[model samples]
Target chain A: MDLPLAIQCEGVSKRYPHFHLQNVDLSFEQGTVMGLVGPNGAGKSTLMRMVMGLIGPDSGSIRVLGHAMPHDQIAAKRHIGFVAEDMRLYESETIAFHMDFVRSIFDSWDDDYAQVLLRRLDLNEKQKVKGLSHGQRVKATLVLALARRPSLLVFDEPTTGLDPAVRKEVLDEMMNALADETRSILFSSHNTLDVEQISDYITFIYGGRVVESSNKEDFLDGWRRLRLTNPHNRPLPDLPNIKEAQQSGQIWTVTVNQYDDALPAQFTQAGLTVTAVERLTLEEIFLSIVLSAKANIQMKVAS
Target chain B: MSTSIVPQLVGKDLRLLSRIILTFVVVSLIFIAILAAIWDHVPAVVQGNFGFILLIGPAGTCGIVMLMKTNVLEKEKSTQAFIMSLPVTVKEFTRAKLWVNLPVFGLFWAAISAVAFYFAFARGLFPLGGVPFVTMVFLGGFVAYTCILAVSLVSQNLGMTVLCIALFEMATSGYLWAIAFLNPISQHIWGAVAVWNPTAVGIVAAQLLVAVSVIVVTLLVQNTKRDFI
Candidate 1:
């Protein structure tokens, strides 16, 4: 039997006068966390918004928790906890008012957990929302989202403006929300450290398209940077999966994806001594993917 | 449909609605009392002149309430974000907008107008012939309020709302001025009894029809919105 998916999007596209999300396909399996890593205006937020049923795609289909988006969104929302920087709580209302308001709508809201979060987050229930700082506001939204214990949590840049201490606490709370094995999370962020610390799977998106998506371990293992000494100055081999190459005198640094143990033999056969092989961090991988994609686009435009 | 969705949204806007409603009621009552006092003491010529002033309360009330609803509640970005994030459809959101403005402002307008019209005709403060003018006042307010409410709901854009108000004001001023001087309505203004000429009745009927049509059109347009955010 095929594994169940919390979210699935195929050939989904949206168009704006200045930007377009083209032919995007992505999926998040049940009981897994998928980190959407991208820079600003990379369509990460747009994709997350589509999955939350906040925006409708111009073409293609999206299913969230097995319900068609923006059509069965009401039913899907019952199981989805969405948090974004643009999403806000009522300013004049107190945290208590919001808690009651959200609790009124969701039958799954847990008062005990809500109380725990309020205490843990150090939020005053009687305090008005506008009085809270930026970090506190984000935490308040998180408290509201998590207390309901949604099956799927979708966060769009939840930690963008938060301080370091608050960011860690929020990330911890997210981890706590995921203690249940059946729960799944799909968060979009430009912060790779947060993604590296929390996500089970990683996806890189750039220029309104997904560059790569895979399990975290597979991504970490598949991309390697090899430092080699090319004394002969022989022409570099046209190796497959070579993302980028840099040279200084006789030393050459080559970055390759889908790296394997057999790659070293190929380097030796080419008469190049492999001095060192270094694993690429998530941030390095993200930069390489974006740069490579940008270079490819530039090359295509030039040609 | 989420059974509690509309009410929940209504509750979100209830505080602002309550404030506007209270202010309108208190201010209208005071204005009506002052008008009644001036009617008792002032000369008949002055009474005839200020009788129309009694309507300023309800008309002003309607305009104020419409302004508050559009400017403070629905059109604000934070409030819109909060509302659109809820597990409610655009239809439900539109219904909530209608619920907040129409009934609250409608009831306030009706209550104040009834009291003002009662003093004007029933209490014999002004000639019953002026009934058509008072009715025109109420109908004009209803049309303007409905147009503003409809535009705010459908577009939720402040610029469109301002444009609608400006156009409604210009059109209302022209219509009122034309009726007061033109053939049909001006002929019956100072008569002994109130008269409902075809033109007067027709204008009133058109106002009612346009009011209801705008509301219906707003709902229909909101239903077709694919992107709630």
Candidate 2:
């Protein structure tokens, strides 16, 4: 099987009473990080849960690391480490107890690696799970998941409770885990910057559907905001792949997905001044994609 | 990247069930010591009397661990990206629970049976000698195991389950005199349950029935689509 893709999901559909997760097709190759970004209730968590075999999709085929879930999820999970935003550890137990308990069960557990992570994360061994601060709790979860040294690590909103400083450290540790090259990560987050910072590929989910998925650099570079003046009073052609456009006074600011050096010349021949053409950041691209999806939905409703 | 594939579902299940078994052992040993202390003075057969407590150990512990994140995919981070990134199947995941459940019950059953055997010999209470009473006690332990599995597998509230055990006895009037007077109106398991030689094989039947029920529920859970509301 050439060790099938780490995640290969197709035509995944899940319907809710008020919201429907539509045809969520996504894939992540081995030895790469894929960041999943979506607004709340956009089905980011739902997708992650399905991958973990925590939940099943309404209609879909999912193969994670060559195992057809969740029939094989048990066997497959052995090599996988998962940490959620609000993972509940035994509140009454000391971190040491949990460490010992987790260590005893998995043959892959590295006691030496665990010790190093604990110190690096600055967590005290004697600290009780309940007594740990929210950031400390996240760090503790990371410590447990990381030291196990699984081939794949799945983090769901891992940085949710951490402050900026803690978040950066956690991200650095995550990056450190991926330094081995064979290890892969799939994380869901609202923080686009985090998504942009570490993700080799990015997927945008909005209102239970994936609006966009592409390489991070390609996504940012693909989007262009060009300034144009409409001198002929001619409406722009309804071009396919033109995600969105905005008008300010006589200037028409158009957002195009596949931007090129030729864009300014086309507007110049139309007797409109081509003032500026600028590349958009991932955050701006994310907003445009979401807004465009909303517009598509609204337009569909109106007609 | 060790050559061996990871099996964390079963692995985690083991860790989870270990604490549960530990708890049961701790609680059971305390009761056994108490039973050993009271064996001579009490008229009741120690083997027959302690069946219910023994039954609840394995399934109850597994249930508590499961309940810890019962809502993991339900109420918490059902992260689409993260969960999908693993290397496992849903059925394999659910099977890990059963793998953990059976052994836990097996351990509990083994422990209590040993205790029951010891207590039966130490105490003089007998059903024409304690062999038949021992058989009956084993049967009750089986029923308790099955009942614990059935209730824990399906139940959402741990407190209510424990309460149900107590309420059920109260409702059926399970005491000896109540059994003597109300035998005509008594229920199936309840009527003969408290007796010296309660039907051990019959309780085994109940256990099988519960085991089947759990399998059926698990299949339903397995095939059903997870929307994660």
Candidate 3:
């Protein structure tokens, strides 16, 4: 049996006066969490909006849950629980009003689950949204989205601008929601810690293009920071996945996307002594990729 | 599931505009009471000439201002984000706004027109010959209303909304004066026999046509929006 994909974006490009998302092809299986990591103005929100059918892509096709986006979006959105940083509840109304409103629209609304989430999220149903704190506001949104029991949850910077405690609470709730194998999640964030903690897959995008995308373990295990000593002041070794290499005196620090046991042997045979081969965290890898991508752009522009 | 969303959205908009609805109801009741109290003791100076103005003036002004305030003139831009996130298409949203807003103005327009017509044609307090003129003037309210609603829904720009309001206000005021002095309407203004001259009927018919056309054009324009957010 073939499980349907939750999201698919092929050759999806959106152009603005100041920004563009060019030919982004992405997909996630039915039961996995994909973290989209990108910097400010890097088109993460644009991509998410395109997937939600909020904005039509300038070119290419987007399919969410097997429905063509922006065309069958009304039908597609029935199974999508989307929350963005800019999206907010009615401020003048009480939380109960919003809950009732959402419940009336969606037959899949789970009242029992909504009540459970209200307690776990520490939200008061009677409290007006304007009176809630920032953390409470986010929690209320989360409660509303989760209680709908959508097949896919898409979050665009959901935990942005929250304190550490609130961020952890939100992440914990998201992880708890993903326990069902049939559900899928896609969240974009600048906070790599949040992404690293809950993401099953990671995709790095920069300058309106995806630079790296793979399983979380593969990314973590495959990338490494190598510390080497060129005692004879030799040139840097040629490696297929060498992303960035910097030298100070006779010591060299090389960041590679593909790292394995044989990499040390290759460096040794190149007349360089390998001193330390340390694994890179997701944050470090993201930074290295972005920096390398920026340098490559500069080189192309210069040439 | 998607079929029920339009009603759901319309229901939400009604809830959002409930305060305005209540205020409208209250103001209409007070005006009706005032008209009932003054029915028997009309001043000779105002009698037989624009007596219904006292009723229609407040109703028309309040109808326009209240509709614009609750729907078109919203500076907060609230509820849009939440509404857009749901399983609603642009057509559904536009339909909901139109469904909720038009009837709101219609209710007030109907009540005010009914009260005025009752006193004029049925009770014989005001001259029946002025019915066509009053009808045409009240229909002017709808023209202003459609202008504001269409512009606000399409542009969502404060400047354009204000411009529409200003143009409609100036045009309505001018048109009312122009129609009141027309030979066909003023010739039979104080007469006992009710008259539906070509000018009066033509103006009323034209106003209704504009109202319907404005609504149809607005809905069609709204359907063209690809970027709803």
Interface RMSD of each: 2.0, 6.6, 1.5
Local distance difference test, per candidate?
0.83, 0.68, 0.84
- Candidate 3 whole-model C-alpha lDDT, 0 to 1: 0.84
The interface root mean square deviation of candidate 1 comes to 2.0
TM-score to native of every candidate shown: 0.93, 0.73, 0.92
Q: Higher lDDT: candidate 1 or 2?
A: 1
In angstroms, give how far residue A143 of model 1 lies from its true place. 1.2
Greater DockQ among 1 and 3 belongs to: 3
Model 2: residues with Cα > 4 Å off, grouped in runs: A1-3, A230-234, B1-145, B155-229
lDDT of 2 by residue, B1-229 (tens): 3222135545654654455657766777676666666655655634456544543454345444443333132124332223233443444444554566656666666666666655544443432243433444454444444444444434424565566555544543343334333333233333323343345344446546765775677646655644322
Cα lDDT tens digits, model 3, A147-172, are 99999999999999889988988999
Model 3 bad stretches (over 4 Å): A238-240, B32-78, B118-126, B180-186
Q: Which structure is stronger by DockQ: 2 or 3?
A: 3
In model 1 chain A, which range of ten residues has the least summed lDDT? A84-93
**DockQ: the better of candidates 1 and 2:** 1
